[model samples]
Target: MTIQRHVPATDAADRAMLEGWLDYHRQTLAQKCEGLTDEQLRTASVPPSDLSLMGLVRHMADVERGWYRRVLAGEDAEPLHYDEADPDGDFHLTGTETWQEAYTTWQAEMDVARRNAAGFGLDDLARGRHRSGERFTLRWIHTHMIEEYARHNGHADLLRERLDGATGD
Candidate 1:
């Protein structure tokens, strides 16, 4: 739903490479959901897996806000798709309308994350502490986010293929 495709350059500067890859992974997630009905998107990839394309979208939105807004930008961040009442709520099927909402929220978080990252240098430390009470750098967050998307995108590929025989990069 209005997702822009991103193709990472094979050669670029450090920041460009990192940003391009993150954007590429983000677009890959959207491509996996393309042309499917909301119900199709909500369909579990495999029995007992509870993994759906919508879930990936929702989960990533939660991650983007948590890392970029709260950690990197030092801003108050509330999860857009989940909470303590149900920590796994992001992956829980809600309704047919959830497809649009997940995508919208994910896109919004991506924008915020971009803006947050833009204000910092790669080595700049975050205001927030890790669970171990260690500070994180912008570079670490960017690398982690890319890896997160990649792992989830792998799940997305399988889910999409199972959903409707669709698959691609």
Candidate 2:
């Protein structure tokens, strides 16, 4: 049940600002999965859908990899590992892998994403194709990441609550 907290942001102004939210969001998600077993993490509390803590970890790994490796770096990232014939596949863990494995994958993806996100100017432009074919800038991507993490963190909070009675800030 032991979890390590991230170190505080340093004196670098840009990093302190840009990475502050990202760090907090990462910690929040980690906190959501704290003190849970593999079976509990893989259990889909909400029926009819396979969304679980392990699934969310896998999904986040896919997301970080997609955005940082594929979209940002143009590396032709394959679909998410859990995306098996269905677009929503990442929301479910369909295999026997342990929760620790999922968490490890998530950490790997986050490390890559953090490295990719570092040193980019807010005004830096990176192109992405959306459903509407709209062009986006790096600033937009950063904002979107923050928004996405926050939104998912809310869902994780509720999911964690359902998993265990332990809940708090």
Candidate 3:
């Protein structure tokens, strides 16, 4: 799969730099999923772990909604595909959810995230109660999102390798 790689700006404002990195990481995840089939995407990374390419997509969609819609935009975001009842539903396809749905949902959330973020500056304050009951800022959310994607992209790398022996930056 040919993943579309975007060159992040070398010299830019703080916001641009952060956004560029975040966008870069986003594309990286998509690149990892580029050539995978439904079965391949649904393939778990390791035993006792439900992590997969499609699962990552679903989980990231949830993440995008949580941060961009709920936290950033304060849009009273409801659960996208998971809840307290089944926290891991994002990763559990169970043959009910198709790979296409995951991709479309992920892209849709990405769109919302981008739109929601457009109005805020880096230092813009958005009150959000984390799962741990901690307040957060839009800046923190941006940095957290980058780290989240980087961590998951690492897992994606391993998963892709397991799936098709693919590897590299």
Candidate 4:
């Protein structure tokens, strides 16, 4: 599918700006994976790293679940693509998962995240805590998600370029 990334407005309010940039980064990752075959999406960036576009998509799906459903909404949401036994299972594809499946899952998680966040204001405290036992404000989660997506999107840029010579912001 084609992905269109809209630039965040320069003068938007804090929450709007954060959500805008977070979504922009999310679409950036999707755009990087566009037009690639399943093999290409599953191809690792380098040996021993296991970082692939498909893996990143799966990872972000879990990330959205973790921060939004598990933390913010206080739901007992389990990781969809990973488990305690294999903490990084999302990044280690088994070749049985189709691109459409992974994309659909990621999109679904994003939808849930949006719904979960909608009930709370930016300054509201989350119902869950970090592994370190620190509580999170919705503002912090939004900022952290933006940073997380931005970093992963950078990896996606390199992976896409290596796969097909495609590169962009």
Candidate 5:
């Protein structure tokens, strides 16, 4: 394993740097999913699990919709990519979906997330009380989403590499 070190941010504002990290991962994830066919995108290189590149795109879309649109906006809406009726529906077979559709949906979701992020004050309070009684603010959710994207991007790196030896950071 190789560790890459990023230089300390020269930017004065901590929040901007954090936002940059979030945007960076969002873009990185998109790049990782670029230019693959539907079969390649949905192919589970590792059996017994349905972790596909296309699936990740769908999942991230759901995350953005759920977090920014639903949780942050406090909207009463059904969850995307998730259902008690079919827990694995999103990943298993995205249903003859064209590459453009998948990519477009991912881009749209990211756009919404960006718009939502723009509306927040540096000190804006975003609160969500978890089922476990833990509370989170918008700042926390923003950072957490960045962490989520970064972690999944790592998985994407390996999975894509395994598929075509096309590895990247």
Candidate 6:
């Protein structure tokens, strides 16, 4: 499927702008993984680092769930790919999940994130605390999510270019 990334409007309200950019980055990540076989999606960037396109998708899914469901909505959501014993489990795939599965899961998490944030204003506090024991406002979460995707999307660009010479913003 083709991923459509809309550029965020420069003159929009804070929440609209944040959501637009976040979605753009999300679609950017999806576009980076398009047209690759499962093995190619799972291919590591380097010998030591287990980072791959599939791993990024899995990681983002967990990130969305953590921030939106666990924090914002106060839902008892569990991590899909990690635990205390294996904190980075999402990035270290067991070779059983297909690319479609990972993509579907990520999209589902995104849907939940949108729903969870719909009723909250920018200054509203989250229901949960960060690892540092600090509570976050909706604005902070939105900004942090954009930064998270932006950084990971950069890694995705490098990985994609390395895999198939495909690169773009």
Error of 1 at 105 (Å): 0.8
Give lDDT for model 5. 0.73
Candidate 2 colliding pairs, count: 0
Q: Tens-digit lDDT track for model 1 on 3-75?
A: 6776777788889989999898888888888888888888886888898888888899999988998888777
Model 6 spans with C-alpha error above 4 angstroms: none
Q: Cα deviation of 160 in candidate 3 (Å)?
A: 0.5
Show pairs that collide, candidate 3.
Answer: none
Clashes of 3: 0
CA-lDDT, candidates in order:
0.86, 0.73, 0.87, 0.91, 0.73, 0.93
Candidate 2 Cα deviation (angstroms), residue 78: 0.9
lDDT digits (tens) for residues 1-169 of candidate 4: 5799999899999989999998999899999999999999999966668899999999999999999998888899888988889999999898887889999999999999999999999999999877678889999999999999999988998889888898888
lDDT of 3 at 16: 85
Task: Give candidate 1 misplaced runs (Cα > 4 Å).
Answer: 1-4
lDDT for model 6, please. Answer: 0.93
Local distance difference test, candidate 1: 0.86
Tens digits of lDDT, candidate 2, 3-111:
6546445765754655677777777788888888888888887677677878887888888887777666555667666445677777756568688888888898889
- Please, what is the TM-score per model? 0.93, 0.84, 0.93, 0.97, 0.84, 0.97
Question: How big is the positional error of residue 154 in model 4, measured in Å on the Cα after superposition?
Answer: 0.8
lDDT of 3 by residue, 1-169 (tens): 4768786779888888888899999999999998778889998967688888999999999999999887888788887878899998888878667778988888899999998888887777765566676657778999999999999999999999989999987
Candidate 6: residue 155 lDDT (0-100): 94
Better of 3 and 4 by TM-score: 4
**How much RMSD separates candidate 6 from the native structure?**
0.9
